[model samples]
Target chain A: MQTVKLPPLFTPPTPDSPVPSVPFATPLPDIHVTLFRNIRNAVDVRNLVIKGDPRVPECVLINAATIVDVFQIQMACTKALLHQQQGIMRTRSLYSEILFNLSPTNNISDAIRQFGISDTTTAVAVVMVGMQAPPEEVRLRLLTLIEGEPIPLSHLPEFTDLPLINRIYKTGNVAADRGQTLALVVGAMALKGHLS
Target chain B: METHEAILIKQGAEARVYKMPFGEGRCAIVKERFKKAYRHPVLDEKLTARRVIQEARCLQRLRRAGVDTPTVYMVDTPNSLIYMEYVDGSSVRDYINSRAPMNDDDERLLAQSIGKSLAVMHDLDIVHGDLTTSNMIVREGSQSLVLIDFGLSMVSSMVEDKAVDLYVLERAMISTHPDTEGMFQCILDTYGKSSKGGKAVRKKLEEVRRRGRKRTAFG
Candidate 1:
C-alpha cells in the first residue's frame, strides 16, 4: 500500500522589532509644493510624495520609530494610516514608528513578512511622527492595531481617561492629497520659523 | 539542452531561446540564463524575481482587462528563465512597411487600434515604459495587435507620467517611421475619444509637443 504525504502549509516569518539605528540625522532640505484644484479629494493619494530619508530611501512603509524621528522634526505621514475599514492620523507626541499594519484581507502574517507595505515602493518616502504617553497604553494600542484585534476605544487609556484625546476612524483608502500635504508642510515650516 | 540543436532558435542578450520537450515533446520554449557581472548576486536574484513576478502580474492584469499579451507558461527566477507563448506572427512594423504606399484609411485604422490598446492600458494606470512598434506583434494582414514586453512596465496613476510615456512613444515613432505625424494625430484623436482624462491629456500632450518642437528647432 502506498502512503500519502501532505504538503507543508505556508507560514510567514514575523518582522524584526525596530532596533535604533544611528541614522544620518540631518534636517529636511527641499520644500516642494504641490497645488490642488480638488480641495475635497486633496487627501486622496493625489499630492503627496512619501520620500524616505537616507537610511530608507525608495520605501513607502515608514517605520513608527522613523515616523517619530521625522515627527520630532515636525514631518507627518502624508499617506493615511489604515486599519480595517478605517483611516487614522495620530496627533500624539510620545511614541512614533511605522504602524506595521494588519492586512484588510485575513492573512495575519503578511504585515510581518513584507516589513509593512505590500509593495514597499522605494520611489516614495514614508515619514513617521511620535509623542509621549504611558508605555503600556501606547504599546497596547499599537499591538492591537498590528495584531488586527478589536481593542475598543475604551481599552485605549488616553481615549478613556482624557476626553481631550480623540480617536477618529473613517472608512476609506487613505491617500495623500498633494495640495494638502504640501500646504501642511509649508504651514508647519512657517510655524517652526515663527517659533525660532 | 539538445532541443536547441534540433530546432536552431536564436538566443537573446540575457536568455537562450530553444524549442523543447515538456511532458514528452509537447511544444515549449526553454529559456537558459546568461550571467551579469555588474550587479551583485543578491540584487541580481531580487531583480530577476521581481521582473518575473511583474511580467506575470502585468500579463494577468492585461488578460483580465482584455488587453493582448502572450501567456507566460513558466518562470524560473533563480535561473532568470521565462517561457512565454512564442507568437506565430509578424511585428506591426513589418506589416506596416510591407503594405506599399499605405492609404489614409489604413493608417487611421491602425492608429485607432493602437490608440484603443493604449487607452485600455492607461485606464488601468499601467505605464508601458517602452511603447514601440517593435514591441507590438501583429497578424499578417494587421487583423489584430498584441503588445509584448512588460520589461519596463510599472504601476502608476500619475496623469503627467502617463502623458510623458505617450509623448516618448510619439518621439520614438517619429524617429523610426517616416511621416508618422498623421498616424499619431489619428492615434491621439482616438485616445481623446476613449480615455476619461482625455482633455487634460490633450492639453498636456500639446505642451509636450511644443517642448519637442522647441528642442528640434534649437537642435
Candidate 2:
C-alpha cells in the first residue's frame, strides 16, 4: 500500500521580529559633495535670476540632513536631485527642487520663493547627485558659479533655514530634537502624493 | 536598493515587509507588494500601486487628524513599495495573551484607547477594514496603542460601513482573547460616548450583528 505524506503546517512567525534579507535591486550611483561657506553676492545671484528662467547662473542652498532622507526612497531617483546628473535639473535647479521637496504642498512657486536660495544665503552645501564627475571638478564648477569659501557640513545647522522649514512642513510641534524633526520630515515627504 | 540592507520581516499573502535602514541610526519598515501570479501583469501592477498609495495616504491623513499610526517614510509607486516608520511595539493580541491575569485598569485603558482611535478615524471618514487586536500595536515604553496595516482601509462614512468596522473588531475579539466580553463591552461603551454620532453607530451595530447572525444561520 502506498502512503501519502502530509505537508508541513505553515506556522506564523512573530510579526514584529526581523526576517531574512532577500535580493535587492540595483545599487545607487556614487555621490560626492562639497560645502561652500561665506558665499559672496548671494543676494545678487538671487536677484539677477528671473522666475522660470534657466539661463541664469544657479546657486541654491539646501538643508543637508533633509536632502539625504529624501533620496533614500526606491522611486526617488526621478524626483530628487541625487539621481540626476548636473545640468539635468537646470530648468528647476536641484537646489530649488530640494527646497520644494521639503514642502508638503505642490506649489513650486511658493516653495521656490520660501526655500530656494536667497540673498541671505551665505553658506551652501553642494553634493554630486548622480554624476560621475570628480569632487574637485564639481567643486570648481560650483566655486566659479558663485564665489564662496568651502565649509564642512557640520556648520550647516547654523545656516539652515529652520524657521522657514518649520513653517513649510508644519512640523514645529513634532519634536524638540532636530533628529525627530528630520524623521517627521522624511515621513511627510514620503507620504506627499498619498495625502488626502 | 543600494548600499543599505533591508531585512525581511514578514511575508504575508499580499506583501513582503522588511526592516530597512532609514535616516542615520533610525530604521524604517518597507512593505513591498510582490507580483501575484494569478492576476494579469498589468492588473496586478495597477492594483498593487493603488493599494500602496491608499495605505500611505491613509496613514498621512490619520496622523494629520492626530490619530496614532505609523509615520510614512517613503512611497515608491513604481516599485510598489511603502517605506514607513518601524514602530517598536507588541501586538495587543500577544500582549494580552502572554501577560494574562493583567491589571484590569490597564486592559480597560488600552481598550478605551482603541475605541477612541477608531472613533476618531470614523469621524475623519476613514475605515479600518481589518480591525483586530493583531493589527493594533501597544507601543513600547509609552504603552500607547497604534493602528497599523492600512492596506484594506479606505475613506468611507456610511453608517453601515462604520457598524461593520466595529462588528469586525467585536468578532475578532471573541475569537482571539479569552474573557474579552468585558473588554469588548467597554470598547462599545467608550466608543458610543466618544463621538457625537456614537449612539447612532451603536444602534447600527446591533442591526449589523442581527444580519450577521442571519447569514450564519441560513448558510
Candidate 3:
C-alpha cells in the first residue's frame, strides 16, 4: 500500500485531530478493476491466508486524516465486486451497511478501546482464519510471500453479488453516557448447501 | 522497511498467518480467524470477539508502555483477523532449541526483560491466561522479546489467576525449551521481584512444583 500524505486540504473530516476535512467516501466506478482484485483477495483469503505463508503483514498505521480515505478505498472494492456479479446463490457471501455514527463524539481510541470497530472497516472482504493460528505455520517456519495470478471477482460468486445482512447497531454508535453497550454484526459465506 | 518474500509461519490454534507485504517490501504476519464447529454458535461468537478485543488491547497497551510488539493494522473484527507489523527473528523456542544457553549476562538480560514485561502486565492487572514460553517471541534488531497471543487473557486483580498463568508457562518451558530448568529460574527470579504476588506466588509455585515432583515420582 502506498502512503500519499494528502496536503492538509485533502484530509477527511476527522473525529478529533485538527487535520483539514474532505468527504473521502466516494461512489464506486463502473469497473474499478484494481479494487475488485483486492476485495477478492481479502474475502476469499482461504487459499491466500490459510494455505499461505507465515510472515506477518506489514501494518499501515493510520492517523485520522488517512483513515477516511482507506474507508473509501474499501467501499470501492466491495462495490466494484458487487457490480460484476452474475446471479444470486443459495446464500449470500457479502454483507454491508449499518453502523452509522452512533454518537458524534465517538473517536478512534474510544472505538478501539471499546471493541467498537472504527468506521474505517465498514466494507472489508475476508476469506478464512481458524480457532488458532493457521495450520501452515507449523510446517514452514518462514514462508515465501504470496505469489500467484490475481483471481478476478467474476470467478468468485461470493464477492461478485454479495448480500447484506440485517442491520447491526443502527440505533446508535457509542452507547448513551458510555454506559454498558453490546454491539453485534453477523456475516458468513455459507458453504454450498450448508444453510437452506 | 525491508520487504522480504512472503513466508508461511507456523499456524496456531486460533489464527492463520501470512507474511504480509509491508512498507519498503518488508513482511509482517497476518492472522485470520477461521471457523470452529466444536463451539456452540453463541459461545463461538462471544469467544471470538472477546479474544480479538483482548489481543488488540494487549498490543496497544504494550506499545504504549514501551514494551515491544507488532503494531496493529486492519482489525477486521468481522473476519476475526488482525494484520500487524511482523517482527523479524526466531521465537525464543527456536533460539533456545538451536543455539542452547547463552552466557550469564545474556541469560540474565533475557530473563530480566521477560520478568519485567510480565511484572508490567500483572501490575496492570492483565492476566495472560495461557502464559507458555511459546507465547513469548524474541524479535531481532532490539533483541527484545514480544508477548503474542493474549487470546485467553483477562483483566483481573486476583493474585491466584496471575500465579496460575506463570505456573502454566513454567510447565510449558520445561517440556519445550531445552535445559530450561535453572535457566527458567532466572525469569521467575526477576518475576518474583516485580510481580504483585511476588512472595506468595513464588511460595505457591513451589507447591505446584512439589505436586509435579510427586506425580512424576508416583508415575
Candidate 4:
C-alpha cells in the first residue's frame, strides 16, 4: 500500500479576496494505491463497482498490468481533482473520472474496457481518492471486497505489460526505459480532451 | 480551505509560473493564466482557455515527435492552469551570460543540439512563436537542450512561419549575446542539414531578414 498527499488544486480563499471563481472542497483528500495479485474474485469486484455498491470506497480498479509507473496514477488523481472541482467531469462519479483520465481518448466506455478489470485479470491496482474514511479502515473493507493477497506497490512493475501500454498510448520508437515511457504516457493523458 | 505553499517563480503578461510540491517528493511547475481585465469577461475566458489548451497540445505533440520538452502533467482549462515537469536546469540565457569566455567546444555542441531540436519541431510543423535563449534550457547532467514556454506556439506548415520563427531567435540572440554571429551560423548549418524543408526555409529566412532590416531602416 502507498499513500500520497496531493497539493490543493486551487488557491484557498483569503480574507481580502473572499471568493474564487471556482470554489473547491476545503481540503483535498490523499490518494491511496493498493496492489493485489492472484485475485480470486475479480468478477465480483467489478460487479460491485458497476452496481454502485456503497461498500466500495470512491476508488477505481485498474488492471495492474497496464500501469507503467506509480506516477501515472498520481497524475490521474490530480486531473480528477481538477475535474471534480470544476464540476466538468464527463463520468458520473469522481472514481470513474480517475479511470477516464488515465485513458488517451475521451470515450468513457472505451477507457473502462481498456483499463478496467476482467474475469481473467489476476492482478489489480485499487486507487482510492478523496474519501473521508481512514485508509486503514478502507483497506480492511477492501480485503473483504477483494479476495486477493495484498502486495506493495513496488511490485507493480513486475506486472506491468510494457508492450500493451505502448500500444495503447501509440508511443512509437520510444525506448523501453521506464522514465521515457512514463513521460509519453502521462503527456498523452494530459492532452486527451484537447487533442486534435 | 486547506492551503499548500506554491512559490511564485515567474510572472509574465499572460501567466504566472509557480513551483509546487507534486507526487512522491517531486516538484512540478504550475502555470496559471490570470484573467485579463482589459478584455471583456466572456472574450477573456474564451481566449485564455484556448491558449491553455494550445500550449498543452504543442508540448505533447513535440514530446511525441521525440523532442526534449517539458512533460505536461495536467491541464485545467476552466481554471487556465497547466502543471508540468519542473526542469532543474539553467536557461541558455543564463548559461551564456555566466561564462565570461565560453568554451569553443561547448558552444559548438550547444548550437548543434539546439539546431537539431528546432529541426525536429519544424518538421512536425510546430512553430514556436516566441523563440529565444531564455526559452531554452540546458539540462543539468545530460546537457541536452529542452524547450519551454509554448504559450504562443502553433502548428503551421508554412515556410514563411518557420522562417519567421528562426528570425525571431536570430534577432534575440544578436541583441542579448555579443559575438554570437558565428554560433548562429553554425546553428543554421546544422538545421539545414537535418530538416527536410530546410532549403526553402533558409531561403525564406534570408528574405525575412532583408525585410526586417528594411523596416528598421525606414523606422
Q: What lDDT score is found at residue B157 in candidate 1?
A: 81
Fraction of true contacts kept, per model? 0.00, 0.39, 0.00, 0.49
Measured on C-alpha atoms, candidate 1 has an lDDT of 0.45
lDDT-wise, the better of 2 and 3 is: 2
Chain A TM value for model 1 = 0.18
Q: Which stretches of candidate 3 lie over 4 Å from their true place?
A: A1-196, B1-8, B40-43, B212-219
- Clash number for every model? 24, 1, 51, 0
Rate residue B119 of model 4 by lDDT. Answer: 96
Output DockQ, candidate 2. 0.22
lDDT of candidates 1 onward, in order: 0.45, 0.65, 0.46, 0.85
lDDT of 2 at B174: 89
Worst 10 residues of 1 chain B by lDDT: B1-10
Encode model 1's per-residue lDDT on B139-178: one tens digit a residue: 5443777887776788888777678778887887877788
Per residue, candidate 1 scores C-alpha lDDT tens digits across A1-196 of 0111111111111114242121111112121111111123212221222222232212233212111112212222221221111333232211122232211122324422322332322211222222234435544433322223222222222111111111111111211332222222222221221211
Candidate 2 vs. true structure, TM-score: 0.76
The sequence of per-residue lDDT tens digits that candidate 3 reaches over residues A75-193 is 22232233224232112222111011111122333322222222232222221111133335421321222222334323323331111111212212322221111111111110101
Docking quality (DockQ) of candidate 1: 0.01
Enumerate residue pairs that collide in model 2.
Answer: A43-A119
Q: TM-score per candidate, in order?
A: 0.47, 0.76, 0.52, 0.91
Q: Which prediction has the highest TM-score against the true structure?
A: 4
> What are the per-residue Cα lDDT tens digits for candidate 2 across A34-125?
56677787776566554534434333444342333323222233345432433434235554555566557677776566555566776555
Using lDDT as the measure, the top candidate is 4
Ranked by lDDT from best down, the candidates are 4, 2, 3, 1
lDDT of 3 by residue, B122-179 (tens): 7777888888766778888768888877767788887666777778888888889767
